[model samples]
Every structure is written in C-alpha cells, then in structure tokens.
Target: MNKVKILNLEIDNLSKVEFLDTLQSGVVFTPNVDHLMKLQKDPEFVQAYSVSNYKVCDSQILLLAARLLGTPIREKISGSDLLPAFYTHHQQNESIKIFLLGAREGVAAQAQQNINLKIGRNIVVGSYSPSFGFENNDLECQQIVEIINNSGATVLVIGVGAPKQEKWICKYKEQLQNIKIFMALGATIDFEAGNMKRAPKWISQIGFEWLFRLLCEPKRLWKRYLIEDIPFLLLILKQKLNLYLTKDYLKKNSKDKRHSWHTAGKY
Candidate 1:
C-alpha cells in the first residue's frame, strides 16, 4: 500500500482501511512498532493532511515521532517524540489553532507553557485536563466537545493513553467538526512538560524505543511490554497470514468463476 495524505498527516498505505473506517465508523486501529519502523524507510509513505477526517494507526504515530527525533528542531525536545513534531509543525506554520485535551491535572497547562517557552509564543489555542477518568461520564464528554468547538481549534491533540484515547477520538470525531485533525498521542503531554524522559537516540534508531520506555517506567509499563508485546506481535503475524491466504483464495475463485462463465455461455 502507498501512503496517502490526509490533513497534514502522512499515513502509510497499509492503513487506508483503518483510516477510512475511523472516518465512517469511528473505530481506529493501532499498528505495531515494526510496521512503524518500516514506514520510516519508505518515502512514499508520507501523507499530507487536508479537510478530511484523519485517523493514524499507532505505527504511523511512532513513525512521525521517529522523524521528529531524527531531525530535532530545538535543543529541548519532548520525551514523547510526537510532541516535538506537533510543536515543530505549529512553529513553522502558525496557521492552525491547536487544542490539548486529556492529561493529568495541570499537565496540559505545563505543556502549553513549555510550547510557548520553546517556540517563543503561545501556539496552543486551548488546553484542558479533565478529572481523572472523565471518559466514563457522558457530561464530561459533552463538555469536552463544547470546549473544543467553542475554541475553534483546527487540531486537537488528546493524551489520554490508549484504548481510551483511540476510543474517544473515534466516538467524538463527528461531533468535533471544527477540528480538522484529531490525534490521540499517548503521554505526549507529560513528555512535553518535561515530566518524562524519551529514549536515547540509539535506542529509538534501533527500534528499542519501547524498551527504553519500559526501563524508565518499569513499574508501570514492564508488564505491558513483557506480556502484551509478544502476543500482540503474534496476532499481527496471524492477521498478515490471513490476508495473504485470502488474497490467494480470491484470485483462485475469480479464475474459476471466469471459467464457469465461459463454459455456461458455450453450452
């Protein structure tokens, strides 16, 4: 698959369905680290964002991070590479107003301040950190929608961490019409606020970014990487095998169907 452009974001070819599906069904899929590493090597995988709904799989998000880290714009880059890219893009082109949602109390404020300090002025249009576990409340969700809509932000960056962040974006993408791009960047706020440490360049380049993160926050992330990462990789492999088999079966079936049509016409 080739990369397609959607609203200032470059998405890899393998993710077209996932991106489109998010637009229609609001269900975003998360891609693994390996796919992200592969995307970085392929220039054709770059995408530009427009007015359409853009949903980036997890792998694509990591690839964006890698690009920013490899080309550091400022001496002080955020722990999560995603923030630097977002910040850098905004700094270069201040045409878009951005909204920050979903971080610990004051984390968004800290991030906003950091961006202002780093970029020499405030680029963030609005920043809000909902109460702990606010996703569970319908009112909170509505309030968030209202805040974003009223702020007139073109992009909304959510840092609620996965599954929640992904789910929230999918669920609310429609209602949040003012925002052109909605990115669910996990823990990017903390990283930007200097609350966390990003992996070293060598670790990121070697695709050991996850390992570095685990070492830094073992108590929180050790179980996730140690237990979930392997199973996740296995599942992705299974999906790839299934796709290959399906493609072969479809080709064979089409050939047989053509033959059957020819025979029937002859008879």
Candidate 2:
C-alpha cells in the first residue's frame, strides 16, 4: 500500500474498491486541496493529519495533480461518494454499526433518518450533532464520546469540519469505545440528509464539483474555493515542473557518462 506524497500530505494510492476492501479500524482523513493548504500553515492541523491512520485523496484536483506530478493516485474517493457506497456495500452486514457525529444540531438526526430510508436503517445505531467549538470544551467533548461509545457503533462518521474532526479524533481516540472506525467526512451528512444536493456525476468527473459547491453556497465557500485553494494549482504546477527538470537532468547525466565511457574504451 504505497502513498502518493503530495505537498505536506501522503495520500494513500488506493482506488475506492481497493480501499473499501481493506478499510482500517482507525482515524481516517479525507483531505482535499483546502485541507492540504491548511496543513501548510496550521501546526495543530498538521498534528491532526500526523496522527491520521489513513489519508485518502478526496479531491479530483489532487487526483489530477498527482498524475501531473508523475505520482498518480489510484482514484478519487470523496467522502460524499464513500458514504452511500459504503452503506450499499455493507447493507446486509448488520454487525457493522455506524454512528453519525457533527453537523448543525438535528442535521445528523435527519441524516440518520434519511439513511435508514435510503441506505439501510439497521446500519446506523447512533448519531449526535455537537455544538460549535465543542472540541474546546472538554465536558461537551466527553459527553459526545460517551454517547458514541454507549451506542455500540463500529464506525463513526465525523463531520464537524476539518482540522477539528481530525484533531478531535487524534486527541480523544483513547476515550472512545466500541467505535472501531473514525472518518472525517466533512459535509457528507448534509448531503446524505437531503439538506445539500451533491454535484452531478459528470460535474464531479470533470473536476467542477468545487464550482458546483461554490454556486450552491457561495457565501460560506467563496473564500475557501477562491482565495485559499487557488495556490494549490500553482503548487501542483511547480511540482510537475520540478519533476520534469529532475528527470531531464538525470537523463542528460546518464547520456554524458555513457559517452565518456565509450571514448575511454576507444583510447
């Protein structure tokens, strides 16, 4: 299981099907360009990703960048897509209990209801929507831990948002019980609950999912999509150029050495 080291993160080079087959029972981070950009400037964020058991490329932008950098990833496994696929795959596996955590209060509850109706009712055992900045409040965080633990769920889908979800899992993993899998699934819950409409498959495939999201919620997402993520493309281009130069230099060096060796032999 090799990882494609991109920027400050090492994303697992795995396709959806391959990754699903070998899902680890630990903290998982599905990082996109914005998350990766944060990893550059934020130390606590770095610490969170550092402790993550699995880092999957959840952005087509990253997937395309990896390919351009000559370290192509297997596939893009966005959280929004993974939730439904995971539920569908494990539909009959009643033993695989799930707990949904995060979102605006009652959003997770709605997600649970939607999932039960659409995906499978039996798979979701528990769900909770934590208050904003709950991670900073030890008592509130502890309560969440206890609720998820007592629910006897095997997987915990955390959507409190990045860095926070990662930091929470990284910091309080020891307190959690029964929950075997922890996934930082961003807004997958909202999408699942029918509160948000996901981009069309064609849009996602063509790498305009971000644009679709921007159009959907420009007020919340404009800064992130425009200001924050613009540099990622430049970074990717820099890596691609550096890679190209390094390979060209190596090839030239090999050719020069071969020519020198031939002249010496003739002498």
What are the per-model C-alpha RMSD values against the true structure? Answer: 13.7, 13.1
Candidate 1 clashes between residue pairs 3 or more apart in a chain or in different chains: 5-48, 6-49, 7-49, 7-50, 8-49, 9-49, 10-47
152: Cα error in model 1, Å = 2.6
Q: What tens-digit string does per-residue lDDT give for candidate 2 at 169-197? A: 88888787677788889889988888889
> What is the C-alpha lDDT profile of model 1 across 1-267, one tens digit per residue?
344432223444433333333332222233344323222222222111122233344442344543443421112122255446555655755666678886778889898888878887567888999876676788988999999999877878787764456556756788988776666667777778777776777766556777887788788777656754444344334443443233343345444443211111000
TM for every model, in the order presented, reads: 0.63, 0.87
Which candidate should be chosen as best, given lDDT against the real structure? 2
Pairs in steric clash, model 2: none
lDDT at 222 for candidate 1? 72
After superposing candidate 1 on the true structure, give the runs of residues whose Cα lies further than 4 Å from its correct spot: 1-30, 33-79, 92-94, 236-267
lDDT of 1 at 88: 66
